[model samples]
Target chain A: MIKVLFFAQIRDQLATSELRMPSSENHNIEMLLSNLKARDSHWQTVLSKTNLLVAVNQTISNENSALQSGDEVAFFPPVTGG
Target chain B: MIKVQTTDFNLQAEHDKLREKSSVGAVVTFSGLVRDINQGKEVSSLTLEHYPGMTEKSLTKIVEQAKSRWNIIDCTVIHRIGELKLSDQIVFVGIASLHRQDAFAACEFIMDYLKTEAPFWKKESTTDNESYWVDAREGDLKALNKWSK
Candidate 1:
C-alpha cells in the first residue's frame, strides 16, 4: 500500500490527514493524483490547486516521480516557516 | 543540532551550544517571533504544523547545505510548533564559525532556505476571532535565487 498524507490548509480543506491506497510499481505521482482527484468534486477542487506541493518518501518530488508499494507520499502547501 | 518541539527554547543556551568549540570566533543567531499584526490584520496567535519525518529531513538538508557553502564550525536550529502567542519565539538559527563573515552569511542562508524548503505551515488567529492559513509569499521563493547566483 502507498501511504498518502496531507497537511496544513489542504488537510483542513479535505478533512483527511492521511489515507492508504493499494499501490503498484507502475503508479507514479501524477497517476496517484488523478486517482485522488477523481474521488469527488471537493477533492478535485482542492487537489487541483496550482501551487500544491508534493513529496515522495519524505523528499520533495514532482508529479513525474515514480512510486512503489509501501512508499509514503505527502501533499501540502508551500512552506512559510522561518 | 536540529530540533522541532512544542516547548519554548532558551536563546542563550542555544547560543552557548553552538559556540562550544574553542576555535569558533563568531556566533550569529536569528530568532523569529510571532507578530501582533500581519498583512493589516491583528494577529492574536499562531499555530504551526509540520510533517514529522519530513520536517527533520528537510531541516537537516538545509543545514548540510549551509555547512557545505561556509566554514561553519557548529550550528543549532530549533523550531517551535503548536500554538504560540504574540511575542512568542517561533524559530531559532545559530551558526558558529572562525570568522564573523562566515557565521553571518551561513546564519542568513539557513534562514532563507528554511523559509522555503522546510515542511512547516502557520495558521494565524486574528483578534477578531477569525483564523486563516498564511499563504506562502512569492518573495520568499525569490529569496532563494540570490543564494544560487
Candidate 2:
C-alpha cells in the first residue's frame, strides 16, 4: 500500500488528509490521480484542476513519475507563504 | 538555524546568535509581517499551515543552498505558524557574512526560494468573517527564476 497525503486547499476541498491505497501494476502518479478522479464528481473536479501540485516521497513530482509500494504521495495547491 | 514555531521569536536574540562568529563582519536581517490588507481585502488575521516533515526538509535544503552560494558565516530562519493577527511577524531571515553583499544576496535568495519551494499555505480571514486561501503569485515564481540564472 501507498500513503496518499493532501494539504491546504485541496485537503479542505476533499475533506481528507490521508489515505492508503494498494499499489497497482505499472502504477504512476497519473494513474493514481485518475483512479482518484473516478471516485466521484467532486473528486474529479478537484483532481482535474490544471494547477494542482504533487509530490512523490516528499519531493516534487510530475504525472510521469513512477510509483512503488510504500511510496508516499501528496497533493496540494500552489504554495502562498513566505 | 531553521525553526518553524508557533510562538513568536526575538529578532535581537537571533541576530546576536548569528553575529557571534568572530569572522562575521556584516549581518543582514529581513522580517515579513502580516498586513492589514491584501488584494483589497481587509484582513483581520492569517492562519498558516505547513507540512511537518516536508517543511523542515525544504527549509534545510534552502539554507544549504544559500550556504553553498555565498560566503556566509552563519544564518537563521524563523517562521511562525498558526493564528497571526495584523502586524504580526510572519517570517524572519538573518544572515551573517564577511561582506554585506554576500549577506544581502544570500538572504534574498533564501527568501525567494522559500516563497515558492516551501510547503506552506496561508489563509486570510477578513473583517466580515469571510476567509479564503491565498493564491500563489506569479511574481514569486519570477523572483525565484532570477536566482537560477
Candidate 3:
C-alpha cells in the first residue's frame, strides 16, 4: 500500500490525516491521484485545480513518477509551507 | 542551524543560543504566529503539517543558501508543526552577522524562501463549520525569484 498525505489547503479539504491505497507492483503516481479523486468527490474537487503540486517521498515530483508500496505521496498548493 | 518539530520553542532562548560573539553587531529575527484572522474571517485554531523527514532538509537548504550569499556569523530557523492556537508562535528565523546588511538580507532571504519552498501545511479552523488552509502567496514566489539565479 502507498501512503498518501495532503498538506495546507489540500489537508483542510480532505479533513483526514492520511490515506492508504493498495498498489500493484506497476502503480504510478498519476494513477494514484486519479484513483483517489475517482473514489471521493472532495478529493476530486480539491485536486481539480491546476495549481496543486505533488511530491513523491519528500521531493517535488511529476505525475508520471513510478510508485512503490512504501512510497508516500504529498499534495501541496505552491509552497506556503513555513 | 534549522529545526522542524512539533514542540514549541522559546524565542529568547533561541536568540541567546545564536548570539555568540561581540563582533556580531546586529541580530535580526522573525517570528510567525498563528493569527486570529485572514480576509476578515476569524481563525479559531490552526494545524501545521509537514513532511516527516523532508521539512528539515528543505530548511537546511534555505539556510545554506542565505549563508552563501551573505557574510553571516550565525543563522537559526525553527518551524513548528501540529495543532496550535491563535497567537502561538509558528516559526522563527534569526540571523547574526558582523554588519546589519548581511543580517537583514539573510533573514529576509530565509523567510522568502521558507514561505514559497518549505513543505509545512496549515489547517485553520474557523468559527463556522468550514475551515481553510492558506494558499501560497504569489508575492512570496516573486520575492524568491529575485534571489534565484
Two-chain DockQ for each candidate model: 0.91, 0.86, 0.62
Model 3: pairs clashing at backbone N, Cα or C within 3 Å = none
Cα RMSD (angstroms) for every candidate in the order listed: 1.0, 1.0, 2.9
State model 2's lDDT.
0.93
- Residue B137, model 3: lDDT of 68
| lDDT digits (tens) for residues B1-149 of candidate 2 | 89999999888998999989799999999999999989899999999999888888899999999999999999898988999999999999999999999999999999999999999999999999999999999999999777878
* Models ranked on DockQ: 1, 2, 3
lDDT of 2 by residue, A5-77 (tens): 9999999999999998889742999899988998899999999998999999888899999999999999999
Candidates ranked by lDDT? 1, 2, 3
TM-score attained by chain A of model 2: 0.96
Q: Write the per-residue lDDT of candidate 3 for residues A7-67, one digit (tens) a residue.
A: 6667766786688988783388788878878877777898887988888888878889999
| TM per prediction | 0.98, 0.97, 0.81
- Superposition error at A45 for model 2 (Å): 0.7
Question: TM-score order of candidates, best first?
Answer: 1, 2, 3
Q: Which docking category, incorrect, acceptable, medium or high, applies to candidate 2? A: high
List ranges where model 1 is wrong by over 4 Å: none
Q: What is the TM-score of chain A in candidate 3?
A: 0.88
Model 3 - which docking category?
Answer: medium
Q: What is the interface RMSD of each candidate, in Å?
A: 0.6, 0.6, 1.7
The deviation in Å at residue B85 for candidate 2 is 0.9
